[model samples]
Target: MKKNLLMWDETLFRDPEVLEIDYLPEQFEFRDSQIREMAFQIRPGLRGGRPLNTVCKGLPGTGKTTSIKKVFQEIEETTKKLVPVYINCQIDNTKFAIISQIYRKLVGHLPPSSGTSFKQVFDAVARILIKEEIVLLVALDDANYLLYENEINKVLYTLLRSHETYEGTRIGVIVIISDMDVDLSRAVDARVASVFRPTEIYFPPYADAEVREIMKARVMQGLFTGVLSESLLDLVVGQTLKSGDLRVGIDLLKRATLSAERAARRSIEREDICGAYEISKYLHLNYTVKTLKDEERQILRFLAERSINDHEMNAGDVYKAVRESVSIGYTRFYEIVKKMDAMRLVNLQYREGKGRTRIITLRYDPIKVLEYLS
Candidate 1:
């Protein structure tokens, strides 16, 4: 009998959900200040006042979304005067989609999928808030997508100025921007900016010690005792620090544990961690790629194919290749490239020459990008 072998019904994970990306841990570490500030901003909503508009700026995996979730959870438990609606802009970047989400949250059902106009839907939402005297606090996660789609001003202007139209309807917005390169000041029109003042909240990357502590807490809750050794845990932390994203570490832990289980082992090992990182390091890349539109993906596919032979190419060359399949103009092609550059999917640089040409380079391995796209 093999003592280390996992039995048919046996497993190492104590609570598998804790390792999931969407899992909200009971003990959220290293974000106390952020949590407090968020609570303070929304405190007024608890007493029938509109919540302050906030701009949560940070790199991905830095607890921006989690903080919002935690605060929203508290609001739900505390009162009904404040209606907290969280919208993922990646999935719903348009004004209609965002307002529909708010409507569903307040009206208890979705509006007509097609026949209903935006005005009808918007009016219904405002009327309900006015009748119920409920304040709306909407958090737009990954708001940069709204910017890419040219919908930021429309969304903000509508939400921020709802009171002007409906007198009693109060709506506030919290925009969560994952990309540090996006400048909201310059992105929005002056009209939207005039009424859309937001208190900026920055979430910096966690320190190495903080990362280790958080990982350890997750390990204790997620896996059984002695399933992972201290040294192996250190290695995981080191890999996470190298990537500068905590999600990679969390995904690595889950993948490595499964790798051990696949081998009929009860405990994780060094080889499992190393093997898992090959896939886990691209966690962010995989997520960002999924949110891209058809044209953006086509541009990335062309770049990946071209990258195999040439490490870099000029913007004009990429545009020419992309035009073969898609009917996009030079200006539109340049806009797509700039959006991808902001998303950190590729590197955009300027070449100092007579022509002042722009250079483009893939940030990840060409093979990996192709695999994800396919």
Candidate 2:
């Protein structure tokens, strides 16, 4: 009898392109047109002109940040005539911190955070720009956040008006928000709103065909030849479109590849893709839960329980339900629902004549929440 041995080659099946969720570029794909347009719009400012103030809106993972970075790279390669800066609003919320970030970018020195009003910082930024004779294009990702927090007006007021006070220098702001639904002109005072009227651009969700093309390319680059079949590709694209999430698709591809590798299989089969989908929900749930506070988690649990028990529960009904069952006050409960809506965990809709009530539906199944709570 001859001895039998199993052999598998893992190197040929590894994924070299799967990015950690937080790393911006490793998972970035497509959006070449948007990058070119942004670079074109900002290029003129380098030769003693005002850069176009642009507002870019898109859902998460739609290549907003990635495209901007790509444009910035081109900008750096082509010319030193303009300065590019990026700030994530969620991480740095206050006016002072934002101004300090811009200051450090322009002046190459970290100024102390005390004894200087926003006016002083603006002056410093203007002086540096004028001295270098460079135009400035600043991108504030998550701009909607500042609008709600009341800090937007102050920051925009300074950036927009710096030209008036500084003389001969140009500063343009590229405001990036999650969606275009926010009518900023109506929100800001007319005087400030007119100055920051940016050229608006919208990024639609990727079509299923586009998703398939992207996934196929990634699979080819990240996995070995003949590793994934059409069946796995179809399933991944369908689930991704149904959920309206690119992260879901990327995650599924990564997991499926890993599953095949772990099983010492040469190729990823349909079963591997199915297994990936089965485990994806838990990863998403943990991500969502990590961002929530204790009260917020309690409120979500309340909504999930009510939603499972009763088919339809409005925001008011859910608020009352949480209040009645838990010791937290009504005010806190209302705030919790609003926060959940912002997180995209719960659906909130306005009924026109009626108040805007939150439709209590979990983005995932209620079983996910139960699993989380347990």
Candidate 1 residue lDDT tens string, 1-374: 87867987888899999899888888788899988888888888888888888999999999999999988998899888899999999999999999999999997998999899999999999999999899999999999999988999999999988888999987788999998989998999998888888889999999999999999999999999999999999999999999999999999999999999888898999999999999999998898899999988998999999999999899988788788899999998999988889888999999999788899999999999999998
Candidate 2 lDDT over 172-270, as tens digits, reads 888888745677667678778788777777777887788888777777766777777888778888877765667777787788777877766667778
Error of 1 at 237 (Å): 0.4
* TM-score for all models, in order of appearance: 0.98, 0.77
Clash statistics: count for each candidate: 0, 0
For candidate 2, give the lDDT of residue 228: 79
Task: Please list the residue runs of candidate 2 whose C-alpha ends up more than 4 Å from where it truly belongs after superposition.
Answer: 1-9, 12-15, 18-33, 107-124, 164-169, 279-336, 349-362, 366-374
